[model samples]
Target chain A: MNISLQTRLLLLMSVALAIGVLVTQQAGRYESRRTAAADIDARLGRVAHTLLLSWQVSNDLTVASIPALTVAPPAPDGKRLPVFEVTTFDNRVLLRSHDFPLRTHALRAAGPGYGNAEIENTRWRVFTVIDSQRRIICRVALNEHDRSLREATLAPHFDQPLLLGVPLILVLGWMSLVYGLRPLRRLSRELARRDATDLAPIRSVDNDAIVEIRALRRTLDGLFERLRHAVNAQRLFTAAAGHELRTPLAGLRTQIEVAQRAPDAQQQTHALERIARAGEHMEKLVSRLLHLARLDSGETEIARHTLDFAALVARISGDYARVACDGVDRPAELQGDASLLEALVTNLLDNACRHAPTDTPVEVTLAHHDHWLTLHVRDHGPGLPEADRARAFDVFYRGENTFGEGSGLGLALVRAIARAHGGHAGIDPPSRDGLCVTVRLPAAHRS
Target chain B: MRILLIEDDPILGDGLQVGLQQAGYSVDWLADGALAADALANDEFDAVILDLALPSRSGRQLLADWRDAGQTVPILVLTAYDALDDRIDGLDGGADDYLVKPVALEELAARLRALVRRSQGQADNCLRWDGIEFNRASGILSIDGQVLDLSAHERQIITALLERPGQTLTREQLASRLYGWDGGPESNSLEVHIHNLRRKLGRQRIKTVRGLGYRMAQPDR
Candidate 1:
């Protein structure tokens, strides 16, 4: 399940809001219940005190049948209205002023103070007082409806402020969250609507909130830069290849044309020779292109094995001896890909053969020191100019004196392969009378 | 010389046939690798010019087959793919030489001659004509016991021209042979050198073929 960023963030905010609201409601409810309990207890204490005062004043009224004391008529609207049965201290019911429901559960046996008890599914707060002079106990009790513990605890939460305000607060919280997240939402929408090539930075109103977004934009920009570079490199390579190819192709065509216009055997034969030379040039160019492409794309895997460099050089020397006026030195043994190494060696040897005088013998030497393998091919031919030396490593940067049928990617490809194997190629000043090329490879096997 | 031309393109094959026959070689051309292979099996030819791309078998494969069958006739492989690997592969597969497409006929015959001579392992390195014996090994010119004082570059150029006497040498060929790689005579350099050599020897010794190149003509009797 892949969740989008918005959905995950919204869910997190919603859960946090819900928990906050519920916790506030629960806390408010608990505080209200505590205050209500305290209110009821205080009211019971006051009622008990009032009843004790009334009993003390009645202590002198015991003569002549107690002269039916006219108790003040109950004022039903008064705040202090009391409802209770009067009883004697000696456990005798004196007067039942009102037939109170739940009379047996009233304050009759309660000792001069407030008490609580449940009677018939209802709870009551009862108060009792004792007058020693009159020897009477007066008790007062009230139905615990309005001032009841459960109602006092539960009522206010349903009243105007809390009941209405909680929902209002929750709605406000949600709206605020939505407003706060607008920038992120806009960024996402803008990103979604863009094409693959549009790698511009996101426009944001709140700069403080989008540090990560800026970092992400930087990363994307880097990727785009690299992609553009790769595309440019490929374009340049193709254009160079095409341009280089035209020379040989044109030569081949002109050779054929020349032959077609030839009036005699001698002329035709000469044209044919030129055509053959052009063909050879084309062949060299093509092979170099393939080798360079293979190296660049990493398509060529190394077949590494312990190679007897001496034997390989000897074989190459023997092969080229008929045409090579220059002699190649014996090579040393090392571990490397035989085919790639052969290419490297052959290219250098062939280059020397092409440049040197027919009578001059090129010298080749191979040696190993520590973990490094080195091979040197030197031609007594004119050495590369110092100015052109660096450019010589660049593809197609043929020297001014180089007139051979070559692709000019020889040294470039050799360098690429050597670098890939954690080695390097260099042009050393000739110890003798020619230009020398040095190839060095690290001893470690690089796959 | 009898030549077997193996090429796929009819226009190129036809052009080559006309050009080669005009150059005095008896030409037998095959349009595909299969036909070339079949012809090679059924008939004997002095030399074979094979094209790399063919219908059934490629020129490289055909050359390999011929060599494997112990055919000692020199095979020159022609290809449109002018890559180094292609050239090396063609050569490695038993081709005596490799050539790119759109070649001139005269150069082709000269190369054929060289290949034939190489195959026969001829000892003489000199082409003798007009009382001049050009020693290819020593890079010296001797005419009736008189040694020509030629510059190294001039000697190399005259030697190449002398190798194929009476034939036009393209500017590209002369430049490549003289300058080591085709750096070409920079700023009328080849013309200047040729002029100097002509003054030393004789103007009639080397003739210029207009718009084509320089050629060492046979003795004008």
Candidate 2:
């Protein structure tokens, strides 16, 4: 499933905290048990010393009334108590406690130390003390089970902190997660409440402590800014296009109305001529609009094939041979979309025809050097100023002081078509009293 | 019929003027919305064909101003805004009818006729007086079962008289209907057309009151 970031972080923390609690609890138990056993052994050694001093003062080795040894009180439940034995070097037991378990084997006579023995199924901690001058041995042992019982009495003390700490950690972890994710939730809510057409940037909240979230908000704001500009540009273009289309349509309607009510053949012919011109203008506008839209959408699939660039130029030039002259230096070949290339050439020639003087001949030239194949179209028209050269290829941008009527989409479409073939188009610096537009493409490999 | 045309575009304004004039409407074209408003306040027109986009003042603003001033002239809105909301706005803004641009000239004329007829409390396309029936659409007059051929000027005079039968029409009113403000009446042009009209329909069909003007003679049912 898709777990949220907060849940994932909480889950990881919970697992780590669980392991910490378990390890701490076990170590507490082990250390407390060891310290308790050591404490018991020290108390037993002190008691044995007192008993030895009494025996030395009396100067008697025979069995007699033994002094009452002050021992630890019995387990609270009265199950077991501290036990002891006094024995000689010859394996004879001289003294013993009332509760000491009877054993069949003789107690091993050894140096004074601490050890463990199992008299029955129960285990015990044994401490031994010896008086070598008197040949007396004193051994004291306590039930291991009793020590565990005492440790258990202190169990709640250790457990209370852990029991309280674990839940506190979980609650604190969950609360922190909720608090930390507040900014993201606020951003989502803000986005959801906005209108579909509202392209305004999301306002960033001040005092956001998380750097990553702040960065994310900045990135989103940047994206929204770009989208708003694009949307505004598109809206302006559509509005302008609507106004442009209405002008021609209005003209066409007026001309047709005039034609319908013309009084004579001469007037009818004049009206018919205007109507035809308006229709042709509308047709050209519509076709250019379609081409520009296709290019803007970036979805036109280009079918590329290897074709002779010089021959293609020659063929295209033939269509405009009456007004345009061609110069093809050598046979240049290129791989590109044929229809798009033809459109590009046609748009260039048409643009020249519309702008250039009727007497001047438009020039078309093609040359290839190294991997680059270039096509150039020069027109003897009122060339664009240096500032307008860059913007002239923008959609619907008309040049200053241009001749004849045009849609203003031809040069833009030419640039788009050229770019689609992995090429570039630009206005070359004029070497004479004319304007030259050049398109450069990568030449196809001979193989 | 007199019409006030408020349009900014010169070509469209000229074309509409010509076409509407040919359709027998005396059109007073105004290129600016403020001028149109001023003219509307001072002049009497049967209907108005208003363009939404205009110079000096927008058409919508002028319409609002006119309606606020209690002008009840039937208005037909002409605009290039073909969206549904634009039509709704135009109608809700007190326009009697709405037409998108590039509308057929015949349709425009018909719509104007319908608007004028409705203003005059007319229900059908034919106006009848006695045995004569006038078809508003074709501008043709028929008596009994026979159609009468009439000149454009004679047709205008008969249409004006037939619109309100039994009511006396002043000579000035009849002259204004026959020729627009620009065309001055000749000394006996109205008399000539009236004579022609009376000769074609019987002389008893029209009665000239002693100094008032003319009225259609009512025939007994």
Candidate 3:
């Protein structure tokens, strides 16, 4: 059962209060009983003492044999009074009368003492005493059926407090609990009335409670902030993807129209070539978009392994030499995931190749420092404006005069991969001839 | 022009077939890439309109196979997805052109004409006639050293007519050339534009094919 927090909290508090009140009530009842028994025993012993001082025990109702003179007349029916055995001071039973069972042997068992006892099957209390000089043992017993009447006589002593004070204590205890938890109730009401988006801390006069509420509010606010950021990023990506796809679609239409009007074989071939180029542009854009989406969705679980940085760079450069050999000169070097690195180097070199004059040289160099590996691609092309350098890495970012069709996710993907690998990518200061870009990867030890 | 159209969707294929027939091209339609490839191997087609998502074998793969086998017939790839990466991949696999779905019939016909023109290596210039000639790229019309500078749109209209010299082009077709799907001219705009062109180029330069459309004539200067 998924118990709500409020219900659980209330139940816990209620259980604690009940246990506390019950224990206190049990203790108070036990203490009152002890005090009452002690008082009854004391009074019975006093009566026995008075009888011993004034008269002697006899087998007749002389002035000394009067019930009040004879050990309080065996507790006077319903009142608990001393019970005694009168003999020739030899501890023999002189008289034995009782409202409840008063054990005469209690005098012998007590060795000339008195105490209180309860009768088994009857609601009674008994106190016994002995007087050796009077040759009498006295016991006081009382029926609890008339307890209220007897307690009325002792009301001035302990009755008022015991009878009236217990319920008052319980009522006061309940009020005290309610007062102590007032701050908690206030916090609950404040939270209950709040909207889901309301992250403000509940105001409280109690410092400790306020601090806890503030901490909770901070955590919730932080989570909402992160959620907003993620949603914004998704929106930006989708808009950029749409714009990137539009240009190629427009280009395709133009290519097809040119091909349709081709009157001869040669014109048709030229028109076909333009269409092919447009198609090639479309393919790369789709793949790049999918790649970015995969990375953004955190679905890229890149396999990690030991890599030879120099070897990887040489291999990529060798592969690029086949494609880029016709133009400029040497191929670009790169070191990273063979597939991902190929895409990275391809995009960079391709960007340079499209923008730079065919005669200008594009150079790539890889260098390793203390704990970093940096790959630099230099192109003798019109470099990006210093102002546009930052915006260059944004998805679908296109420069002013880039010639061939491009998706514009090349640098964005490169940036994402760099961050994923705990590295960084950025544009460097251009040489007099053209632009330069440097990508730095943390060495294995640093990583 | 004999064109092979490999489209899987029956509605689009039927529409394209009827449209191409109306536009004066012989169109052979196939629903499967494999059958299209087979037909291409056995028969001669001036051009091929290949849908990328064809049954049996994908259009891209068919184009690749045909190109690998040295088939030089112009292949125009058609697809629903207009993604750049998909376009690039299609072209890279040897498709001559890529077009998206829901294309206008006139636009498709124009594209086929362009593709055929490109395959012939014809530049966008040099329209020849009886002793008079028009150069579209340079916007110049020459008749025995009398050079006339024509506006770009006039040159485009003349060049379009010169593509099929004596063939009729409806007013709607002329309007399509002037304005794309968006921002078309107002009513009777094509006639007004043609009248202005005829007055500048001389009345005999163009002929109105009755009940058909307009056409450029080989003038007997």
Candidate 4:
């Protein structure tokens, strides 16, 4: 059940207390009652022996049959004392105690053992024994009302302490637990007081913190530290992105202003040409940013479709001159998103065209082997240095000699599109001075 | 006036240089921070337009180095970082002024003129002699109350002469002021400009030295 720890503990302790008290109470009552009853029976046997001795003495001395004396009634104050009787063998009553107006066969029924009898509507426990030497019988009895195992003395002693201890133990247990859990409560309160932007580490409230509490605090501190780093990194990245975007914007504005205030037609034309270049640069930057954003955000699902890979490459490479497509006539089919695939081929061609020398031709090679399709785009331009080969696919990483209009996102987007189709892209050194990129995709036949 | 433009971006640098040059200030461009620092140490510029992020070194480092060396040339920081912390740091680290990118060319020119004037301790932004008035901010030349139209080359030459009315300047010095580190027409062009100026202004206003180039005549008190 969804219960608090304190309440749950209290509930379990209370149930244990109830069972403990019940067992002890019942066992005590049973033991005490049996002991009291046995004690009462022993006293009755002693009294019977005493009475027989006294009667035997009186009968042997023949002292006028004990002078027919009458014992005084029991001591006052409504106590039903034990009663006794003496009788001869012929069923004659010699003496009796607890005097009653009428007696009916009290000494004649039981032979020589303890028995129960009703005399004047009062039940009695009778211990009857025969005195052979005195030729008489002696019987001592106690009424059921005078039984020792009543609910008076032991009830208060046994039940009162346990009943009172319930509240005491509950309150004390609850208080001690609250003290032990103080650190946890303090931590929660401190967390609740923090603002959303506050990622500071939580501090220890005391010098002697428990190990569990200390461990919890350490975990929380670690999380907050990571969050702080992430936030700072995001802020820095946004600032960098803003700076990159604004530089081109500033260029475009300055060029437009220059054109507007040009002194002559030739100067105006020069400014306009720069302005057009600035526009092109801005367009490339923005489109690259959008592509990266879309890829990161997972907004565009990679819709799988079967298409001719060779045909796609040929169609995209049609824009660039001196592009020789080898092994591209066959219908090399693969399952991937059409639009994303189109973008992928276009970016590969764009990178090749930008890097390749004007007169040299860009080479496109597409081939399929075993359940995989491989495509290569090669350019005979200044090959990238080995040091820059690894990070060349990083977004916005422009090479040292790179100029305006190179957004530096072409290879990065190509790799992203290639990976979305359960494929990989990598760079390979060409035979001579050029950059050759290779992409591998799972062919449709694999399925 | 002349300006040194230190920017890493090719398109922005080329455009800003052209705009500033067209506004009648000779502009020299540097694309690397180390080269910029070296040029500032050797040559003279009326003002400097610095981009904060650059290759070889950062603009802030150069600014600190220049300020530490007690160079009093006015520096205007032009950068794409619009953050408050960046601005505060740039200004507090010895920059004469700070501006975010995408600034209007006219505003940039005006700020540069103001920076130059302030460094020269000219409060009214005007230097007057021989009944001729020049406003640095507008690059406007007027005589007394009437405005006078002059070509860009003539305006530059006369403005330089007006700043130092009693000092004679050589032809190379004047040409260097009009075109910094870049080729201009030959020395005879200076004489043609001087001829054009003498035609517009009185002959006595521009005194031609035999060996030295030219000087504005000291007005009679």
State which candidate has the highest lDDT. 4
lDDT of candidate 3 over B107-143, digit per residue (tens)? 7777877787787576644667665677533457877
> How would you class the docking of model 2?
incorrect
DockQ of every predicted complex: 0.07, 0.12, 0.02, 0.45
Task: Identify the leading candidate in terms of DockQ.
Answer: 4
Ten-residue region with minimum lDDT total, candidate 1 chain B? B176-185
Categorize the docking of model 4: acceptable
The stretch of ten residues in a row with the least summed lDDT in candidate 2 chain A is A103-112
Query: With candidate 3 superimposed using the best TM-score fit, by how many Å does residue B110's alpha carbon deviate from the native?
Result: 15
Two-way DockQ contest, 1 vs 2, winner: 2
lDDT of 2 at B201: 93
Off by over 4 Å in 2: A1-20, A38-65, A70-81, A104-112, A129-135, A168-180, A204-207, A265-277, A321-326, B1-221
Query: How do all models score by TM-score?
Result: 0.53, 0.65, 0.52, 0.73
Provide the lowest-lDDT 10-residue window in model 2 chain B: B176-185
What lDDT tens digits, residue by residue, belong to model 2 across residues A271-290?
Answer: 67767777787887888788
Better of 1 and 4 by TM-score: 4
lDDT of 1 at A380: 80
Candidate 1 C-alpha lDDT tens digits along B32-69: 56667878776645578887756546677788788889
Model 4 per-residue lDDT tens digits across residues A103-161: 64763576688777777677767788987876887777776667643334445666677
Q: Top TM-score: which candidate number? A: 4
Chain B TM-scores per candidate, in order, are: 0.56, 0.88, 0.58, 0.92
Residue runs of model 4 more than 4 Å from their true location after superposition: A1-152, A177-181, A259-280, A308-334, A341-401, A405-419, A423-447, B29-44, B55-73, B88-94, B119-121, B129-131, B143-147, B164-190, B207-212, B217-221
Native-vs-model 3 lDDT? Answer: 0.64
